[model samples]
Target: MAERLADWKQSLDVALFATRMNFRSHLVHPGEVVLANLGALVQAVSGAAVFMLALSTTGVVHGWTLAQWAVLTGFTTVARALWNTVFFGTLDIPDMVRSGELDHYLVRPANPLMLILFSKVDTDVWVEIVIGLGMMGVALQASGAEVGAAVLLFIPVALVGSALVFAAMHLAVTSLSFWLRYDAMLSMLVWRFDSFAQLPMSFYPKWVVAVFSTVVPFAFVGYYPCLYILGKTDSPFVWAFPLAGPLLLIPAVLLWRRGIARYSSTGS
Candidate 1:
């Protein structure tokens, strides 16, 4: 038992070390880092200016003061930025599989999925996160919202939940590599999903909301949690809804594991 415990701890340490290494490698990649930062800056400036202009035209947003809208938009922007930075390659699984590079990944000591997910970091996305927080702050001030301890407590839970949702969704798409000869279709579909994700869920039809929320689980990306932060929903569900984002991983990871096993058997 002691030996087994030691082995487990050693593995955990290695995994943590690998994660740090992955982050360090990203910092060293000057070209990718610069491009990412530039993209992020553009997104942030464009989003903020557009929102300000739209709100100014109406003189108030849908029951949300200008500040409140900024908060929601801020969360949305930061969430997308973080996901793109960390898991940008999830969409490339199909290509990886087709090129037979996935075979190499499977032989590595660490988890293939983790390696794939953390391998890339576009530092430019940080711009979006920064701008997003700025927007949220503007919203908070406009809405006159108080920062109670309870609300602050929910922030991390919500953030982590958002990350999980991202991983789960990306994994799900990548798993198709096991079955499809090409993932061009999946890539196109997931990118389109991004635009849908950007829109406020309330603006969509009820069925559209249902499809993305329960079926695809993208709503958890921003809408549901943002609603809770806005005090738009008080259901105990809101407190726990963020948790639902990561829950998307259960099936996605399981499917990926199963697909990998089949791939191993086929040697393809």
Candidate 2:
């Protein structure tokens, strides 16, 4: 247990250092960061506007009031922002493999997966975070949900779980590049599936819900957690929803290791 603890600490330290280095690189071009973040903010605002416009006409979507939908949207946005900030670079894994850049990562003493995962940081994620929090606040006010201690504690857990679920999904998909060699279509498909999280699960057909909830389990990332916090769900299993992210990592990591073993450099 002590050895495992120490290894975990070391990995955390390496991840922190990588994050700092990426942040410093972003800081070197402050104007670029600001402009990029502004673009993200605009996109988020536009999405919120569209939701609001639709709600104005119907006042509810699949039994969820506008406020409830806002909460779902906020959670989804924040979870996705966390994933993008940490793991968006993984989307480039196929290109890296194709160009043999992954060989440098493999030769590093630190865990190559961690090195590649944290090598790039999207500073624009701050925009989504800010907007997401703002939306959550609005939802809470409109929903009149009590901000209790348990809910407060659970929020962080849910966010971490959501991030893990997203990261694991990305890892599993991108790792396929190791075998497929060049195509990014699978990764792009999984990435686009994130859109499912922005709306209420009830809005979808039963089959769609089954696919996203059981097959992909993206619903646990934001929907279920939001329901738990909002007191809309009574399932005892809701308490364990956070584990879904880390638990999914077991298979994802195994697949990634298999992919690594099969990787052959492009010799670029």
Candidate 3:
């Protein structure tokens, strides 16, 4: 048990160190960082602005209230932002494959996937987390939901689960690049697919929900979890869904392993 605990600690330390290095690497341009972050703030605020303006009409969409929609927005925003900021680096597999850059990761002593995932960080987009949380807090207050330790805990847990779910989808799609080197258009669609997820799954048709629930599990990414967060539903699936998210990682990792084995490297 002690050895296992130490192993976990070591992994955590390495991950933290890699993330810090990646963060610093992106911060080298102070002027670029400032201007980019300002643009990010405007982008985030504009998205929220559009949502509020649209909802100002019906006061609801697909039977969810403004405040509930706010929670949903927050869930989607934070989860997507988290993935974009931290884990999206894994999507660079194709570029690495083409440029021979991935050899650096393969030569490292640490896990190649870890090196790839934490290999990059976006300092400019980091503020999206704050914006998302602000949306949630304001929406929760407007809805009169109790703000306490439990809610606080659930929000972070939900955010992590949601982000992982999205990342799993991304990783699985990205792995395809190793096999389908010429299919850039298809892979590009993977990230854009999140636009469908921003709204509650209820807004979509039955088939859409079915695919999201079973295949990609985008429902668990934000929809059902948002329901639980807002006290709207008590389905055991809502609670179990997020916990089961990492299960998707099993297949994603398998794909990564196979893809790496298949990788011919630019030198070859």
Best model per TM-score: 2
Separate clash counts for every candidate: 3, 0, 0
Q: Which of the predicted structures, 1 or 3, would earn the higher TM-score when compared with the native?
A: 3
Write candidate 1's Cα lDDT for 1-268 as tens digits.
Answer: 9977776565555556766777788778678878867876886798688868887777554455666667767776677767786678677788777777877666766677767766654556767778877777777767777767877788667877776787788778778878877665876677677756555677678999899888787788777887777777678878877777667889988988888888843355
**Per-candidate RMSD, Å:** 3.0, 2.0, 2.6
- How would you encode candidate 2's per-residue C-alpha lDDT over 1-268 as one tens digit per residue? 9987786677667867988998898899899989998899899999999888888778766778888888888988998999887788888888888888889887765677777777888888989999998998889789877878888888889998999999888888888888885458888898888888877888888998899888888888888899888889768888799999999888998988998898889865
Ranking by lDDT: 2, 3, 1
Query: How high is each candidate's TM-score?
Result: 0.85, 0.92, 0.89
Clashing residue pairs in candidate 1 are 36-124, 37-124, 67-139
TM-score of 3: 0.89
Instruction: Locate the minimum summed-lDDT window of 10 residues in model 3.
Output: 236-245
Decreasing TM-score order of the candidates: 2, 3, 1
> Which ranges of candidate 2 are over 4 A from the true structure?
1-15
Off by over 4 Å in 1: 1-32, 60-65, 264-268
